[model samples]
Target: MTERLLAFLILCLVAGAPFGAALMWTGNLILDFVFFYPLFMSGLWTFGGLYYWLHWERFWPWSPDAPPPTLKGTPWISILIPCHNEAEHGADTVLSALNQRYPHVEVIAIDDGSTDDTGAMLDRLADTHARLRVIHLARNQGKAMALRMGALAARSEYLVCIDGDAILHRDAAVYLAAPLVDHPRVGAVTGNPRVRTRSTLIGRVQVGEFSSIVGLIKRTQRVYGQVFTVSGVVAAFRRGALDRVGYWSLDMVTEDIDISWKLQRDHWSIFFEPRALCWILMPETLRGLWKQRLRWAQGGAEVFLKNLPGIRAWRHRRLWPMALEYCVSTIWAFALALSMALWTTGLFVALPGHIQVETLMPPAFTGMALAAACLLQFCISVFIDHRYEHGLFRALYWVIWYPLAYWLIGLLTTLYGFPRVMLRRHRARARWNSPDRGIKAPTS
Candidate 1:
């Protein structure tokens, strides 16, 4: 029975890949027709253009007209900052948390065995700030482990995890916690992360991508109460929920994703609050950006494989939508790679007739229209994001190159991730390599 079950599972995977590929091809073809037809492409482009248009208003920061909520008697919040060789920015992150307008907050900066001056900095920060505390690890551990330790040590009812490189806005904590006041079922709330450095072209492109893809999609998902992953840069969780989920899983590279999945399994609703913003420094160079995205892609694959069974077994009707979105998305990566191969090969094949270039013009025109529409979509997102960040000149320049860069990056990372997941070759423990920090030997 065991052998039979294993064979059946392999067969199912084999069958699913081709079926998924066909579905993706069909979906793309339909999209092409709807967004590229000469008569309809413009209209569809205008309508599809609304995603970015809506994103602007949807993700704009909280209005001053709307008064801040009166804290429900000041719920004690334990702010967790997982630091790994972030000595340069450690003090800044801690200071940001300590400077929060919200009273009754405990800030815990976990030094995850940094070889640098991070521990000493944390200690110095703790000396001045009464609310600040520090945890020291003897050996280097990944962010997941650091977060788990911080969560376990939290004395408050609520926990807020912020990356060491992230700077929280004054109202960030208050905005993140306000949701819990009304929604008892909410287990976690993700704050918006804005790009702090748009000085480089790569940073500018990422800023646009974040606004259009991550920011917009997350808001839509939030509307449905089905946010997939909480931003690791800044997110708040109920201590009870973290305890119930056994804290962050150290096995996955993307601990944020793993915890979100676990929370969903435990029937906890995750929310995306655009009102709360955390400023983060984006990768300034292409090499740095590539490494950052590659880690995310690999981590996504790791999480999907680790939680596939539980996700499939979920009983809620909403779980199907979530699962389908995730599974189909991963499978579509392979399909896209395959389609690119076909398109490349097709260019070399020739027919033995008078080649009417006009015959191919329709598809070419369709492709161009689709591309233009996609660019317009990005422009809309940038406009919305710029309302808060104000990098209009840089954003407009980056928009032209973003689509191609995004596609190529996705393709390369997904290709690299697919085989690693399939062969079960990834380390169960999350790797602590900081891709944003240039790959260099750390000096003590």
Candidate 2:
């Protein structure tokens, strides 16, 4: 472990020195990092997003009503919906899974000791619907355990998992399962999740976020031949692959990210299926959004720390890009915190007038360039994703305010989460914490 830490330290210095020197040379270390780093990453992901769209997504038939992919034989699939306190959306979610256009499929709804009517609703649905099965856990096992229970009871080799609040598109199963069925080595296929709650400004901004940021990232990552993580809200897995990886880790805060890394480490391929659309909700308030993002950031940090040692193997070379990018991003988060600290200190202690603090401030030209890059990135993402989501352009107004907000949230979350993960010693069993699911609107 000490050797590994030393090696990681060396790697960071080797990779970060040139950039650090460049920032120091400019005498605007904080401003350059705060402004230029994201701009640089923005350009990278934009290029990748464009390449993915032009070379891949554009050629595919992506009409909302397009037919399911033709397969030699239809395999029986088990759709697992794990719930805690999801009574409000449980029934709708189950029905959406059961309503899939795929012929041979069953729905397994696991009520993970919900304190609400979610379990009863699932039981009622199972009693009436032959295809629906309900599992009642006596205690609140986390989502990973709930899924593990469902997978154990699943009757099919193919498994599709969705959160209890998601409404699966009728043809979603067909798209999600196609890659697993066709490619013998393909182990998992993650679907695209469209934001369903749009009544509030935060909710509406998330709509563009899912498309412009999340969707674009997935597409770009696919182009890179490995994805950082799968969409946990909606994804399909080959039962064999799940078994090979020992299923989801009980201690993993983000099972989806951990499983993605595990599968890839074990030589299993994961695909991103944009056509497999699932309508989901997001946090509609600042407090709720902060809690949600902080958890996500912590989960990501946990996964990174767990996987870095294993990543040294030659066989895991394919995962290098993701690992490197994650490492850099974590460092960037720390850099932002350091910059803020220096700026605060500068305010109290007299510093030379020439030594300007650059936390939130940047030169006009630099700021304009960064803004333009962000706009371009958003435009490209919306253009590529508008086909999958209608009225996407209308959300541009909301999204215009997204980049700055997103950066702040990301910066703060990582700053908090990275240290928490490092200082934390106990690995407790992961538990569920429900977030604000935002107000619901008509599905139509």
Candidate 3:
């Protein structure tokens, strides 16, 4: 661990020094890109969201009242909830799955070596709900392994896996499976994820984060005929598709990303199912939030390297844009870092009023323009999910926290994760730690 830490530090310094010096040279150009990039991303998302929402039937053909069309036998789906130390909310998760309105469904709840009472909760629930199956591991392997165990035991052709803490929408399984059953080539479907814990300002910010950024990007990725990955929170996959892609990777820090890349590279189609919603709790503290984002970013970098060689093949042409998008995002992250450093240095060593902070920010209207973009994106997102108006519309007074918190968090995680991922080419360890489950109904 010590050696790896040293190597990561060396990599960061070696990379940061040259970029820092260059930013001091071309200061103005970098600032323009920083301001303009948000607008560009917002535009892409706006177009993508409108296109996907307007053309909803392109993915989900079955109406809300209609059941999914199945052939021959009963169309069954196994809902896998992989948990570790989630006993606090394990029952809630299982109850949500058990409450799924889909007629033919089972909940496979795995208690992954939790030191808490997670296993007992599952057992008691299993005894009550005939559709619930419990698997208790003696020791905590990682989430990927736990999911694999549940998948292997599932009897259905269609499988949906969500985090142990996620509360599934009453009809999530039906919506998630519509595309898969309707379109034979569709391998996996990701649902629209909403924030559950709004007890603190941090949780409220994540509500907008999901709707404004995460939600928009998934829609846009769908418009392009490929999404980087399925949402781990509530994604459904066909067993045949899982077999083709060799199932989820046990060694990946982010199995969700690894599986996404594998499926896309193999020519399997992935879709976003907005009607299939899952409400999840998020970290309400900065420490927890930073760790969560860092882990996610690290997973992206790892998946990028793992699939870098495929770019040379002619069949992998569709995947090139995804790779380019991540790379550009990394560049944007570094550019933001550079802009900040230059601004900081100017604060100390400016030539008597010559250098100003605006020198690093856009010349005019960028702030107002960016704020407008955020509001516009939020409004569009909430329109698709009107039930959550209080999370976005009513919270607009506090929405300003989203950009300030997200920008800093995004930049730092990209910087930190990129270096660690780069240095980890030789040796990378996969360890999973559960985040704060946040307020879980105040425990009676």
The number of the candidate with the highest TM-score is: 2
Instruction: For candidate 1, write residues 1-444 as lDDT tens digits.
Output: 543454356435733674444454453453333223323422333343355346554554455235555677678878999998898766777888888878878899999888889889889888888888899999888999998889888898678889987888777887888776667888999998877665667766776777766776676666555767899889999888888889888888788888888898889999877767787877877778877888788777666666665666537556566666655555445555544544454577752222211122236666676567666666666655565565554666676677668767876887786555556633667747754733221111
**Residue 196 in model 1: shift from native, Å?**
1.5
Residue ranges of candidate 2 with Cα displaced over 4 Å: 1-27, 351-360
User: What is the C-alpha lDDT profile of model 3 across 1-444, one tens digit per residue?
Assistant: 665665566456545643654635456556677788877787788778878878873454544455544433558889999999988777888888888777899889888889888888788888888998999889878898888899999999889999988888778887788788888998999997788777888887787788877887898898887798889888999889889989988878899999999988889999888778788878888788888889899898888867876665989988887888887677788877766866788777763232234466465688788878877877787675554334367766565567777777878998899887777646343545889766643311
Give the Cα-based TM-score of candidate 1 against the true structure. Answer: 0.83
- Total backbone clashes of model 3? 0
**Candidate 2, residue 326: lDDT:** 86
- In order of appearance, the predictions have TM-scores of 0.83, 0.93, 0.88
- True-structure lDDT of candidate 1: 0.70
Q: Where does candidate 3 clash, by residue pair?
A: none
Off by over 4 Å in 1: 1-67, 343-362, 437-444
lDDT for model 3, on a 0 to 1 scale? 0.78
RMSD of each: 5.5, 2.8, 4.1
